[model samples]
Target chain A: MVCIMKFDNEKCGYCGACTSVCPNSSLELTENKLIIETDKCDDCKRCSIVCPLGAFLEVEGN
Target chain B: MKYDVIVVGGRIGGSVSSLFASKNDLDVLMIEKQPEIGVPLQCAEATSEETFQTIGIKPSNRYICSEIHGAELHSPDGNHFRMYPHNDEIGYILDRKVFDKSIAIQSAKAGTDIMVKTTVKDLIIREGKVKGVIAKHLGRTMEIEADLVIAADGVGSNVARMAGIDTLFGTKDIGSCVQYKMVGMDVDPNLMQIYFGNEIAPGGYVWIFPNEDGVTNVGVGIRNHKKTAYHYLNKFLSNFEATPVEMNIGGVPLSGTVDKTYTDGLLVVGDAAGHVDPLTGGGIHLTVICAKIAGEVAAEAIKGEDISAEFLKRYEERWNDKVGNVIKKSLKYRKVLDKLNDKELNALAKFMKGRDLDSITSASLLGLVKESPSLVRHLKDII
Candidate 1:
């Protein structure tokens, strides 16, 4: 089992604070969307903790 | 290649560290993940002249975009006060990209090997001692050994965590920031402006800094707010008839220094160590100052053949001695300011209306609380 981070486009402000605070460099914000490289993510939940808009969600996966 | 020191992140802090280490005749290597240094600048680019003097670097025309003479602070109720430096120039608005590159160039000139487009994957820790780094350069993974590793990697520091140091910053401790380089603006070229109002920026403030090229950097920062900094920045920009040339967004760790900045063979400098001021959110000056100390100490450790945490404690001790009290006071002040409502903020501003910048010290704040006993509740910790 593994955990993944998800970005909510509707709620995300795209300020890139989540990306800057992500310890693994797992997140990037483009012009229209927030991209998460699942392979690079260690599921530390830092992005979720730091997102001011509560845009990041944690999901368990196989 | 093995090096006496490995400096990560290649920004002002990393570059300064590399420069100082290499100048002391140590084998230093600086690594940056960016293809080019300082692209997509993340700062409002306002710094004081004293910063350059303290860093022992002369002001260069290549990056000095504007020289500001003074600043104006606008309170929540629209009451404003201006403060000027006793000297001619108060600060400078920088072309951050050029300024950052200049630091990198100086590092190279000081005999430091620089590698760009390189990403540090993890630390090569042996038996709980950091020995080197696992990095990817040009799509190739490699292990680079070093006597000491300096993590100057901004707010989100992978190196610090990889070295078993806690680098977590709570939402309240971090300031979410967004800014735009706007042209065609009608702003005072020599006067920077700061606006403080909960309606404008809930837990933070808005700043308008002008450049010599007729452009202005307009931005806002807030902590743990429902509305993001982008929301506030957009609202602020709407009032100006200006076109945005560039947009920058990032987080600033405003919690002062981390609990620990050094371990065996490792030192965390700059924003990675949370050296930014809690109230103002400025890190460049602190970064340079701390990085210089880190460099000097790392070089001495290498020469002494002692890269233990015991030896590295000098770096922390020296930096704490230099700015620890100031950061402590600023954090206390921020706590007091955060608890005030708009009415209280306005009243405090009114009380401080005729005071100059120097009078904004802790003593004046305590004096204000004395005059208005109602403020005692909020300012008790600060006083």
Candidate 2:
């Protein structure tokens, strides 16, 4: 089982805390957009843990 | 593969350590987890000209964004205190990516091998001694051996933890920070501003550092706050009409140094060792200072074939001799600042209204505490 990642555009302050903590380099903020490459994400939920804005949400799926 | 020194994390600390070691004719390897050396900049990027002079590096214009001579401090009640340097440039805003990469390039030229996109899984320890590391690079897990391993990895240092060092900092000791690179704002490009208040930043302060291109890094850092740093930053941004070009956030360990920075065959430097300023959250200068010591000591130890904890203690002793007292004093000041209410902050600002910048040293801070006898208790740690 894998976790589906959801990002709230309005809520994210784009601080890149999530990107910095993601062990797999699965998340990135480019041009003010938060990009999450699902294949590289290993369901660690580290992004959600470190995000100050709590913009990342992990849902069980796939 | 083997090397005389393996420096983890390719940022300023790791790169400088590698450079100094290689300059001493030691085989040094630097490994960075990121694909690129300095992408996703995580700093407010402000440092003094003295920092470069201390590191013995001539200032490069390639990455200097702005030169500053003064700063403005704002209290919660709209009181402001202005400070100016007596005779020289006091601060600078940096293009961190360019600055960091420039140092890395210099290290490479000094004969250091650098590997990017390599993630260190764990330390290779045999019989209570750190032997090397196991890392994954380009889909291959490889074991790299080194006589000495220098952990310059930032605050979330895996190397220190894997070595069984207690790197945990209390929540009150961590500063949560969020910053935005903004443009099209009406701000004095020459003055860095710091705002203080409970409503603005609970246990920390807000800063607006302007660059030469009219872009500004506006940010907030708070300690022991219930809300997230971005929440406060978003609220602060609501007051501005500027457009944000980029956003960066990270946690700074404001606690003093870790319990121990050196073990047999292993040394921790930079944020990994919690060398950041407790009051200002600045680490670049301290990182470079400590990394330089680490490099020199590691090179000498390897040369003498004595990479033992007792010998490595010199790195810690030299760094503490240079900056330990300042850090301790700052931590005492931070504790005093933490307990101050908005009214008292305004009062302190009022007292500082006419003070000259050069006169406001740590000793002067003690004098300020004397003015407010209530604050005298906090000086026990400082005095």
Instruction: Give fnat, all candidates.
Output: 0.22, 0.14
Query: Best candidate, DockQ-wise?
Result: 1
Q: What is the per-residue lDDT of model 2 for residues B1-383, given as tens digits with 9 covering 90 to 100?
A: 99999999898889888888899999999998878887768889988886687658888789988888788999999999998777766788888889888889989999999999887778888777788889888779999999999998777566877787766555567677888899976788888999999999898999999976879999899875557778888888898899899988777778889989999889999887888889988888888888888899989999999888899899899989987888888888888888888877886787689987455677877777767755545444544
**lDDT values for all models:** 0.83, 0.81
TM-score of chain B in each prediction: 0.94, 0.94
DockQ (model 2, Cα): 0.14
Tens-digit lDDT string for candidate 1 (B1-383):
79999999888889988888988999999998878888768888988876787668899888998888888888888988777876666689899899989989988998999989888888889877898899887779999999899998777677887898877677778898888888987878989999888898888899999987788998888887766677788887787788998888778898878999999999999988988888898878878889889999999999999999999999999999988888888888998888887777777777767886566777777777766666667866754
- Point to the candidate with the largest lDDT: 1
- Give the residue spans of candidate 2 off by over 4 A: A1-51, A55-62, B85-89, B357-383
